[model samples]
Target: MSGTSGSYNAVTWLLDRNVDEGRGAKLAFTDTVSELTYGDLQRQTRCVANMLRRLGVRREERVAMIMLDTTDFPSVFLGAIRAGIVPVPLNTLLTTDQYAYVLADSRARVLFVSEALYPVVKDIVGRMPDLEHVVVSGNDAFGHKKLSDELAGENESFATVPTHAEEPAFWLYSSGSTGMPKGVRHLHSNLQATAETYGEQVLGIKESDVCLSAAKLFFAYGLGNALTFPMSVGASTVLNAERPTPARMYELLNRYNPTIFYGAPTLFASMLNDAATKNERAGTGLRVCTSAGEALPESVGNAWKARFGVDILDGVGSTELLHIFLSNAPGDIKYGCSGRPVPGYKVRLVNEAGEEVPDGEVGELLVEAPSAAEGYWNQRSKTRQTFQGHWTYTGDKYTRDADGRYTFCGRADDMFKVSGIWVSPFEVESALITHPAVLQAAVVPEADSEGLLKPKAFVVLRPDCNTDGLYESLKEHVKQKIGPWKYPRWIDVVDSLPMTATGKIQRFKLRDGAS
Candidate 1:
């Protein structure tokens, strides 16, 4: 298969060769109980692709997918790619209003939904004027077309539509931490480059490995780590339809004995909390574990290693970059640092003037990588602001040590002034996590009587900690760790921290709830 020059897609590169040469390799999908192999997967995807074309899906059009992390999800996703339509996988957990926002923002013509979620989207789908076709993955509900029936008698060998390397292949919505979700568009070449750089350099995945992640397929980190990277290496993947609770995740790990475990810091912390008895249940086949989305504190890294006997390689990536841009690889693992930049990518810390910051100084992180997205869809102003020259400003404030390892400070927007001194919420939050009594913490600026913003913390206590008198103890703990000014002026001990669908702490929600 010659490389596509102005005519290549990720599905084309991933499946074409396999269908022709490596047809016998095994690819398994364990949704709830049933499992399917690579051969079965290929045939099913082709069948669905044939159905999609017959239903009038055309090249370069958008097809929205709103489903859980089931086996059928991947089948539909790859099938859409085969049919020349870009798959826009939306977060299944989004509210009806949020779903409506994304549907309007992307201008998706078709929507593929799972039977389980049809009720949630059924009433709202009628209002989405742009949606013309509805395909259901399981039992037909609300008079929608059955996914299995769509390709019941179709051919399994339709040719993929020719596409340029620079053409949009897929769209992933931004976290919308600040406001409305923006569509982050990526080219076919960007996906391929992600496989080449991070897949090869950081993950070092092999065909013999079995990949699994707690991340849902909707998020780019999960989609790439769970599907694209493993498929690129000819490795099989395990997709759990259920939410990734620590117990369920351990079951998948023990059952399949996956070689690579990819997840975020919150998931890692959950696993550590369950490690007392679950460690012995872990599969010996596991070799590498990775954490992304947010910084993995040194304490969490050390605790995980002590229990699982494997280092958790931490990395930092964004929706704009599509995948992990900076990561510590297998052997040269750093506990706290979100490693050096992956091969073929350059990272810089710049001040407000866009000048390079001195070593050990905190500044905005900017990345120049081939895998970076073209721009946010339909938002030209943001696109221009985010992508300047060859670099994509990450909006993450960080400091590089003398040894060149990047340490996450906090989001540039999350930095607040306390007593006329700048304070990073991440620094305070990370320090809070180090105490055994704290599970997770989010720090925000709460306005005082004079309308002056001061640091306040919302803390989730660990399982063993007593809730009584905990707030004062935590405040004192912070006072001892950093200084008098860094201590939270007010502390709210909560049952849990509110998080986005992708597991990021919704600091804005916490801040709003404080008042």
Candidate 2:
């Protein structure tokens, strides 16, 4: 929080500060395969920086990390920033073609890919003319320069870069409403800005806490949760490199006993529905849990608290704003709402005419925060539209109450009128999730027999649920819970909903296939 003025680097604030405070021997990170202490992290970070420099990756140049959650992640990520090199952490789950597109777009000079993921990017490596080296992390480097070889001769005594705080630090590719990835550039000051505002003010992250996040490091939410927030206060983090399934989550929870856990809404619902975990308490030492990526359904939130004895601090965040600017914190929480703006941020609900709407009306949400991204890379028009002078336009639709609580109303393009009134897909889905038989739900507008747009549902049911007379039962349940006009006219029972790699429901796909 102190040094963001002229010459500041995030490495000194997040990693080196802990070492200076005499937490050098304390565990900084414990991954599935290895653990790293603060002292080890500091030394490793410097070595990585020297390695990048030796590889001829110059200042302000790009390096891509297609890595899993591991102890090596922080060393590489912080090392790049410390030496004035930009590190782009990409989604490990992307296809080879997607990887090629992003690598070419960013023009990354070196790619540090994990050994397990080498197969995916192997064939595409030749197509990248700008990509100079393919350094593999694990053993069996697969005929490429290994990361250990690059760091072996390097000394752990590199000087930190005296880059301006407003200078670009890194880039995160965001697949906005169009589903195309564009590089979102963030400044050196943005990391600590989010840590101070949301991490310090809302979540109250501390040194004694141990953190676990089902959200991967590739995401903005995960970066703040597992990396910046915990490291900001000298806390420890547990990183899981494998899939975060229900059983796997419980295994980690029982083993590490993380005090703060971060996950998406769908994961929470599935965990609650998993037969073995139905009556289970939360992690023995869990003080709090967080839900993001999508709005938390009321039924899921209330049920989780009842069973686990902790609250799910459901909040709204994006790749553009970096982390949760609007959130439901510990005390002033309501299940279905995205609480309020964090202490250092501001939000507004604007109508189509760009005028701020009054409370109780739906409008597009815009946020004013210190951590907002500079703009999209190579997207001047979009950057102008999204990052307006002082406010960043969020593509979400929300309604505010008199007390400043914001309730999600689907996406701006997803809302449609039923009976000449706006219908929030989230509202209908929340109602559907309250029913005993329904495990998950997605609602989209479909043409009725009369050719009018009406609510239609796709639901994933509980394993023990009987399907006989189920559609009618669900219909009546939703009608009684919300209102008659808001109930779904048709229901399609399905095994799973279509989801993006980021865990968001691909409603546009459902709308395209609507009856």
Candidate 3:
């Protein structure tokens, strides 16, 4: 049997492992007004687990949660795990139809929703025949039991259900940037492996540190930042129940004074563009900042450092990998490049023939990590194609340096051919955004009059910029920065580019002429 074969419940190992070791009194999670000590978290999780079991939630039964940055999210998530139920966290920003699709696909029996989000899915709840109950936070007016009311009567002493470490613990649906989202199935030991490797070795998360993430708890990046990493180290996390706008983020940083901050490149760029960000940065107490979900443009990174005096450690991970497998560590960052693989994970850049590519040549990224999900839920074809034995194939393309650092070269599907030559959209987009007038940029191949495809750029210019001569100016800037052939043949200045919930530009939508 493997090391992960024994009966090992993750919630038990994470929650009850250290409650008697002097960490019980420490702050585990907090919002603006409410907080939960480690002791309080342990008890609340137990209560939630007991309530779910009484509701007839059996082992491996799915319990879905549509929650924001509140304490209820983590409490219910851990509680589901304690009773051996699989917890599925859905994206809060998704449409009601999208939520209905996931609930139906996952066959979830019980759903926990926040009061703010319940209204979005209330109409569709009747359409989902598989869902038996709806549990809501803040208020019970939405034809469901109040989460607080249910936890009030239950005692906080349920026994942790025993299960193998490889057993299913949770499921996170992939951000449906391509098409329909696929459910990624993670195991009991996956969270702990990432916490020990990435949390301990890469980020050096400590008990004294207070963490804040603009990324919400639903996405994988935010899940690690706000829940897994902080809880594993007994650190406190500042929760933001509201949407993370520039103003809200600035207020949280000034109010909470967190030591570590996590955000995607879009969020960082928004803060850099906001003039009011300067007023709130006087005493943020920030020591480390992390960026993920998309490649952090070098220009954006440089501007953030110049204004904030903090380096954004850019990294790359996916829904299948659970957390960051490759990352830039503190004091060891290279601008615009995803750094070396974190400890305990092996990364390979392989050609289409499954052979390792030479240095400086682009190839598909293949990762082998213990924290990786078992496979996509109910996706046998995708599982066989992506996960071969211990190696999981990442669809993104990259090139490696002699120093073992990885540089992202866009997704395999994002690479397009132009005039019989291959072009990387990310490379061209990076060059386009360097122009003074360009705020954000995305490149895609558009057909010319001759029916041959050429690079076309969709750009969002800086506020109050002259749009009269901007199109030609951006084209010339790209030509000067990169080669003429790589320059965008047609440039369209737009108000804004389409984005995913995780802050990544949805290029597929742009390619379809939807933007």
Q: RMSD, each candidate, Å?
A: 2.0, 1.2, 1.7
> Which tens-of-lDDT digit does each residue in 479-513 have in candidate 2?
89989999999898888998876688888888888
Model 2: pairs clashing at backbone N, Cα or C within 3 Å? none
lDDT per model, in order? 0.83, 0.91, 0.87
User: Tens digits of per-residue lDDT for model 3 on 1-515?
Assistant: 13375789887767776587789988989988789888999999999989998998899999999987888888999999998999999999888888988999999999999898888999988779899889998866476899999999898889889888989999999996776789999999998998998888989998888999988888888999998998887889999999899999888888889999999988888888876665558236888899999999999889888888988889998889988999999878897899999999998888879999999888999999989898888889999999999999989999889888898878888877776766888889999888877788999888888987888899888887777777777788888887788888888878899999888888888889922
The TM-score of predicted model 1 comes to 0.95
TM-scores, one per candidate? 0.95, 0.98, 0.97
lDDT of 1: 0.83
* Model 1 clashing residue pairs (backbone): 6-164, 7-163, 27-38
lDDT of 1 by residue, 1-515 (tens): 23556577677777665656665457656665566677777787788778777878787788899988888887888888777778999988878888888988888888999888888788788889888888888876569788777777789787777777788888899887878889999887877788888888788888788988898889889988777887787788888788888888888888889989998899888877865545545578888898888889888899888878887889988889998898888888888788898999999999899899998887999999888898998899999999998999999998898888888888888887788877888878988988778989999999999998888998888777776777778888888887879888888888888888778888888878876
Off by over 4 Å in 3: 1-3
Please give the clash total of every predicted structure, in order.
3, 0, 0
Arrange candidates, best TM-score first.
Answer: 2, 3, 1
